[model samples]
Target: MNAIEVNVKNGYKVIVDNGIFDKIPEYALTLADYTTVTIVSDSNVAPLYIERLKKGFLRANKRVLTYVIEAGEQSKNLSNYAAILSFLANNDFKRKDLLVALGGGVVGDLTGFVASTYHRGVDFIQVPTTLLAGIDSSVGGKTAVDIKEGKNLVGAFYQPKGVFFDIETLNTLPEKEMINGFGELVKYGILMGGTLWKNLLSDNLSLENCIADSIRYKAEIVEKDEFDNGVRALLNLGHTLAHSVENLSGYTVPHGLAVGYGIRRIAKACKNNGLLQNSEYEQIINVLDKFSLTYIAPFSDNALIRASVKDKKAFADSINIIVINAIGNCSIQKFKLDKLGEFFND
Candidate 1:
């Protein structure tokens, strides 16, 4: 096991390894200082590992409560958010209590949002099951639920007390979920490049090392800009378009898959605009192909542009877009919102 410490205002460690799900209670006890724990999971995950998690807390002499939301991106909404908040309140969960997000990104995001808002703030930890959560959302502290207007438009930057990534749990995931995760891994590969990028191009990518490397890169950025006012937005390399696509599709598109489509569109746009080299553009497309992430968005360029204007990154008349200068190198560019159609049309 490896504990990668994220140094922020309320810093915490990201623990990664096989079978580390068994160690979650121990980490929670050490980090959260809670009397009770609410393990928030989704329908897909509850039947698989909820009992083991419950038993662990019970053995630690702690009270454990479980809440299972219907599994899907649509569940990450104000309705479920309100329901979980009411659940915590009715159960008399207090500030000292802990929340354990025990599924993938949706569970982690919704739970973290609840933990952040319940009583103004409480402690929470992430035990990410899917590869996408383990590498991305589980560690970022960017908690959010979707609103009618946009994905993750309403939320907080509340940090978790700890993050436990158990690779063993990933065995239960469907092939589609694994493909979803590979989308984010491809994003990381493009962002950080070098061996991480090189390793992802191969069939034998190491999950353990890849997770650690991705988290380490994210940790460095989060430490520098925890509130995401600056450089940290680079992490949204393909997310701007991803979120827009998701919102346009009414979130039926899985986040990682939407991200895959978004990355391709942005890469093509960058190449057309003479920002990314043709070789690097082809490399990104090839990588997406290797991972089966080449699904084109059903929406047109104009529709995507309209949806993107409402993204959280939009302000006044311009929006921040992460543009690739090359693989392993990118920058946040402020594009006039009206020109987005032109940019994408290119």
Candidate 2:
């Protein structure tokens, strides 16, 4: 059990590990005093490992409940959030109970939102089944659902009790999904630099191993800044355009894919702004290309620029962008949202 303890602002430790699910009973034993646990997942993931997690919790003598919703970004809405809360209410879940988010980013986001609002707040654990969840969503306490207006419009910064990453689960992930997740891993490298980028460039590394390291990197950041008021925003390296793409695509594009596209565009934008050198930008593009990501946006330049203006990061008239200063460092830049038009022009 390789455990990394993430000390969030509240002084609670979030433990992350590979193959932690097999030791679920032991993990649950550590939190046995909680009144009840509601394990929330999506349709796609439930069929894969829900039973094993349930059995593990049962073995630890924890009373467990399960809620399974449809998979995909479309399901992340007010209705699903309400449904999960209603389930918690019907199940007599208390403030002291636990909510286990046991799937990908969608499940984690929805469950975390439900946990944050249910009885004002409750302890929740993240059992991220997808590569994206393990590397990004699960570690941060950012819980949200999409509204008619935009992605993550209705959300809260609620940290999890812990995040458990089971690498074995990746064996079942589709190749496309793995590629999507790899895009996020690459984002971390682009934003933070360090061993992550090096490992991604290394031919010997496997997706599963890279994911564990990405999660570790995210955990380290969240431990230092839980609220995303400062360094945490660095994690949004490609998210500004990514969210815009998601909103424009009506969510047909997966979050990771949209992020992959956003990263490419951002690299271009950075080069245009003279923040990133041409060679560096090309290297970033090359890595994204290796993953088979569609580095180009599907929409027209004007449409993409318009969608970006609606991003929540837009303050007043300028958009806050987390741009890469180099391979390992990032900085936040505020640009007139309209100024992004140049990047789209041929």
Candidate 3:
């Protein structure tokens, strides 16, 4: 069992272990013994994990309920957010009760937002199923839904009381789902300088260590800048391009794949500006290619450029993007929004 403790507003423990799903009820007791649990899941995951989770809570004699939503990026919007809020309201969930986010990133974010807002705040736990969620979104307090304008436009930095990572579920994951987490996982390698980058290049990097390194990097960032007023932005290394590609593709593409393509684009920009060396840039591409993450956007160069302007990171004059200064370290560069055109298909 690998357990990481995060120090935030509502500090939480992220437990990563094999077959932790069966232990959900066991951990819930450690959070709050006598609270109601509303497990928020999506269509894709509900059929797989819901009954097991429900049974876990029931065994502990805790009153349990579930709220299911369609599984997709589109589902993380105002309509579903409102629906979840209504579910809790109608059920009379108190602030002392618990909201268990029981799926991947989308489910976690939407449920966390609902927990944060409903009754001014309620206790919530994260049980992220996807590799993407397990490595990134599940540990962080960040939660939000997308709008027509952009991704994560409406959300909050609301911490969960606990996060449980059930690695056994990964055995059931589709190939694309594995790539989704790998997309975000690569960012940690870029942000910190050390053996992490070197280890990532080798064929022997275990799945558990990959997730752990990513969480450790993210946990430290969130601790210092929980509100995202500073260093936390470093975590968004390839995200600016990520949002644009997803927007241009109409979100038909998976976020992890889009992030891979976005990271490719950002690497090009870094190489052009001399921030990254020729060999280092090629090595980054090699790693991505090895992971089967080489993707090209179907959108035109101009279209991608235009889509980037709508990102939340874009200010009236500039947008914040992470540039690779070396293999293991990345730095945020604020460039004129119009100059974002520099990153288009090259």
lDDT of each: 0.89, 0.79, 0.84
TM-score of each: 0.93, 0.91, 0.94
Candidate 2 similarity to native, TM-score? 0.91
lDDT of 1 by residue, 1-346 (tens): 7789999988889989988776679778987567889999999999999999999899999999999999988899999999999999999999889999999999999999999899999999899999899999998699999887666878999999889888899899999999999888998989999888888777897878888889988899999999888999898889888988887887688777899998998999999998999998999999999888977788888778778877767798999999999988989999988888888775
Model 3 RMSD in Å is 1.8
lDDT head-to-head 1 vs 2, winner: 1
Per-candidate clashes come to 0, 1, 1
Lowest lDDT 10-residue stretch of candidate 3: 337-346
Candidate 2 residues lying further than 4 Å off, grouped into runs, are 12-18, 206-209, 342-346
Which pairs in model 3 have colliding backbones? 132-181
The alpha-carbon deviation from the true structure for residue 317 of candidate 1, after best TM-score superposition, in angstroms, is 3.0
Q: For candidate 1, what is the TM-score?
A: 0.93
Residue 195 Cα positional deviation in candidate 1, in Å, after optimal superposition = 2.2
lDDT of 3 by residue, 22-94 (tens): 8877887887765688999999899999999999899988889899999988889989999999988898877
